[model samples]
Target: MTPPVIETRALAIGHGRQPLGRDIAFSLAAGEVLCLLGPNGSGKTTFFRTLLGLLPVLAGEVRVCGEAVAGWSRAAFARQVGYVPQAHAGVFPFTVAEVVLMGRLARIGRFSAPSRQDRDIAADCLDMLGILPLHDRVYTAISGGERQLVLIARALAQQPALLVMDEPTASLDFGNQIRVLDHIGRLRGQGMAVLMSTHQPEHALRVADRIALFNAGQVIADGPPAAMITPARLASLYGVSESAVSASLSPLLSPERNVLP
Candidate 1:
């Protein structure tokens, strides 16, 4: 059987001498979307950075494609893992196509220019995100939501086996949020593994094959959405009352009345 695209065993993360999360464990396989749900400041971003080897692990190990992540060179890792971080403006006013084309850097030679094939892949990625028209727009001039989509397109251009996205829908409007989630589902069907952090439980229910609840610096629960997204679980994770959770979720997710009256 093929090994998981990413795996963590007894992992610990932190900054310098401080610790954020420990004993972290999970594995994401090909064709799966694993959603991380947590409150703000819950260390989800820290965990992602550790997995990508941006920060040193305090303990344990992170493995990608059956090899230790710490052992892989930066270029080798980029060839395997694509990252979509929170959207922000670039220092320079690069065109959207130029920004997406940067993803091809890992595959290109040190001194060579981007090839026709690379440009084609970047354009295809932009088209995939329904943002082909933004190709000529200035990255710094677009709206935040548009920038977010452009970042996703850039990551897709990498054509990596695994994608690690931090709050992919953060700046998106509702329609675009759904579009991104639906595209995530499609990516799974195409045999890519995705590890994304989101604050929206409803989004996880829609797209994730498994949900991991991060709270107080640990994975409090990891399971199927049906089993993990109950009123009690969400309430505890967010420090809200269970009754409130039920009241808010029932009208949307309840079997009898999924539509609001």
Candidate 2:
């Protein structure tokens, strides 16, 4: 069997003397998209942080691209894993291209300028997200959707083997959400592994090759979307009525609506 791109063995994630969830064991293969579904404050962020080595693993192991994450050098890990955090307050007025170019910092030495090739990669990423025209616009001045695309582009510029995103499309319009998710789907097709956390099950059912339902601090269910997204599993995860989950997600399973809102 081919080794997985990412693997977590009995991982226990938490913060400040509190364990948010149970032990987790899973592996994500190349060209796969794994969507994490959970209610707010269900330790999704903690899990993401743990995977990125931002938070210490209380127990167990995390391996990325066949090496223990804790054992890898910071620069080497950064090149292998690209992370896109939730929207943040931007104080700098840098242009969109400038913001995206920052992802290349690890590849370039301090105080060294970006080469033409670096600029080209950034521009290509912008074009991939259909935001090439916004390259010259100030990052702070652009709309939320545009900012989201720029952040994604920045992550792509890292040329990572795995992309991890926290709520990549939490506050976007319907059209923009589809656009962003579609772009993510394309990346998986091109052989990049993606793991993203989202509250919207409909979105997960549409774009995710696999779904992992997290509750209380651990993944209660993990499988292909068709197996894990049933009404029974979703209801238990969200503590909602089964009928409601069925009703809200039925449309998502339709072929016509799978790619759009």
Candidate 3:
């Protein structure tokens, strides 16, 4: 049997001396897209960092590609797991192509220069994301949407089996949101296991194969989007009445029975 790309068993994640979320048992297999849906400060970021090995797991285990994450070195782990962070201001003056090429550094020794194939892969990633024209632009000079695309391209250049994205469409306009979601869907079709966090229930409906509903630091529900995102479940997760949820969701999700004239 092919092992999952990432698996957490009885996992507890948070800062040292403080556990934020517990019993977060889940497995993400290749060609899967699992969306973590939660409100702000609900420990979604904490869980994400822990899975990326940036923070310590307070208990339980996280295995990536059949081996314990704790046993893998930074470079070894990065080779198989890539991360796409929320778009942020860049302090450095690195060009877009340069930033994408940085992903290959996991395989390239720190002291070594990027090889021809490394450059090719970077270019390919940019092309794949339809952002090859931004190759020479200063990373900080791009708009938020473009910056997010660049970050996705950078993670793709890593050629990882599993990708973790944090709010990939957070600040984008409506069209950009669809574009980002489309890219995510494309990646899933290409057999990459994706674990991403988002606040938008609609985004989960559009892209997630599975939804993990988070509330008060733990996963309240985990299942296919169709099964997990009922009006009652959403209302419970967000502490609202089911009628309010149905009303808000009806326009984009179904008939307008919940809404009134």
Candidate 4:
């Protein structure tokens, strides 16, 4: 069998002298979208940091693209994994295209400017995300939804095998949330492995090929969205009354042809 693009074996994710959650064991195959669902402070962010190699692994191991992450250089890792943070403070006045082109810095090498090919790739990424029209606009002047799209395009410009997004639609309106999730679903269809953390189970059920529910520093459930996101499971995971959980999911459980995977 082909090895997964990302694998964590008994992985312990944490920050300075503090372990976030339990040891995690999971693998993400190419073309799969794995959604990490948990409430705030449930170690979701810590887990993402660990996966991106931003946080130290207190125990276990994390392997990316069939090699230990620690064994690979930072540049090599960046080339393979594209990460989009939850929020970005845009202090500079760079154009959207310029921000997106920064994704190619790892490939461009230090002290070297981007070449024609790099610009072409950046443009292609913007086009792929349907944001090419905004390439010339100032990033800080765009709407929040547009900024999110720019960030996603930037990640895509890296041409990574895996895309990791913390909260792709944290504070967006309903329409923007659907737009972002739809774009991510398309990325998975294009053979990119995607892992996103979300507070909404309905979002996961709609787009994720697999779902991993995190609680108290460990994954309590990991499986297909249909199997793992039932009312009973959600109630247990959220520590809520079972009836309340069922009531809240009525809309999701209703018949809908466009239901999430």
Candidate 5:
């Protein structure tokens, strides 16, 4: 049997000597979309950072392709995992194409310039994200929605087997948010495993195969969207009243309305 694309066993995460989270056990298979939903300060980003080897794992392990992540070299890790951080303003004015092409660095030689093939891949990624027309635009000049799409395109340019996105739709207009979710569905259909974090349970319902709810610095629940996103569970996760969660989500959770309001 094939091993999971990414897995964590008794994983713990933290900053310096302070532990932010622990017992993050999970596995993601190819073509699956696993979404992490949680309140702010619940260690979602810290878990991501630890998985990407940016911070030290306070305990336990992160594995990719059934091997410990610490055993993989940085280049090997980059080739296997593409990361899409929340979109932010760029200080430099690199063209969108140039920004996407940066993802190709892991595959290129140390001293080589981007070849025609690299350019083609970057263009394809841009086109895939429906922002091909923005290829030559200055990254710093695009709207936030456009910039988010550009960042996704950049991660896709890596052509990695797994994509880890942190709040891919945060701060976007409603239309752009839907667009990002639609593209995520498409990417999963094309057989890339996706692990993403989101503040919105509605977004998980739209695209995720499995949902993980984080609270108190750990995943409190993990299962199908329908099973994991109930009013009671969401109330506990976000410190809201169950009736409030039910009322606010009634329109969203109704069988007739699959689309977010």
Candidate 6:
């Protein structure tokens, strides 16, 4: 069998010598969406930083594209893996197209300007995400939802084998959240592996091929959404009762909105 696009084995994640989570073993295969469901301070950010090579691993290993993450340089790593942070205010004077075009840096010839092909790829990514109309707009001037879409477009422009998104939908309104989730759903069909952290169980159910129940820096459970997102599981994950979970999710878990395949 082919190796997973991203794998963490017996890993410990935190900053410096601090270990927030341990025994963090998981693998994400091509054409799969793995959702990490957890609350704030559950060490989700620490875990992502470790996987992205931003923080050192206190123990064990993290591999990306079947190679050790610590050994890959920034340019090579950017080509194989892309990242979308939770929010972006763009803080730069670049336009939307310019921002997306930055994804091509790792692929572009050193010290050379972006090529026509690079621009084409960026434009295609924007079109794919339905944001082509905003190509000329200043990135920082756009609304929060538009900026979120822009960030996703930039990551897609990298043409990566794996995409790691940190709470991509945290600040979006209802409509925008659905848009982001729909785009994520489409990525698996394109054979791109995705690992994302989300607090919304309903969102995880809608888009994840597998859901890992994370709490107190540990993955308490891992499986398909149907099996992992039950009332009892939700209750356990969120420290609530099964009846309350069922009551809150009644509409989402209804006959018409069922996400099980």
**Highest-lDDT candidate:** 1
Winner of 2 and 4 under TM-score: 2
Ranking by lDDT: 1, 5, 6, 3, 2, 4
The TM-score values for the models, in the order shown, are: 0.96, 0.93, 0.94, 0.93, 0.95, 0.95
Instruction: Give lDDT per model, in order.
Output: 0.91, 0.88, 0.89, 0.87, 0.89, 0.89
Candidate 2: pairs in clash:
21-217
Between prediction 3 and prediction 6, the one with superior TM-score is 6
All-Cα superposition RMSD per candidate: 1.8, 1.9, 3.0, 1.9, 1.6, 1.6
Q: Flag clash pairs in model 3.
A: none
lDDT of 6 by residue, 133-183 (tens): 999999989898899888999999999999999999988888878888998
lDDT by residue for model 2 (92-150), tens: 99999999998888787558999999999999999988899999999999987778878
In the predicted model 1, the residue pairs found to clash are none
Alpha carbon lDDT at 117, candidate 3: 97
Where is the poorest 10-residue window by lDDT in model 3? 252-261
After best superposition, candidate 5 residue 181: deviation in angstroms?
0.8
* Poorly placed runs, candidate 4 (over 4 Å): 256-261
Give residue 63's error in model 2 in angstroms. Answer: 0.5
Q: What order do you get sorting by TM-score, best first?
A: 1, 5, 6, 3, 2, 4
> What is the Å distance of residue 34 in model 5 from its true position?
0.6
Local accuracy of candidate 5 as per-residue lDDT tens digits, 75-188: 899998999888678999999999999999999956889999999999998887779999889999999889888889888989899999999898688877887899899989
| Model 4, residue 259: C-alpha shift (Å) | 5.3
Candidate 1 lDDT over residue span 91-194, tens digit each: 89899999999888889956889999999999999998899999999999999999999999988988899999999998999889988998999999999999
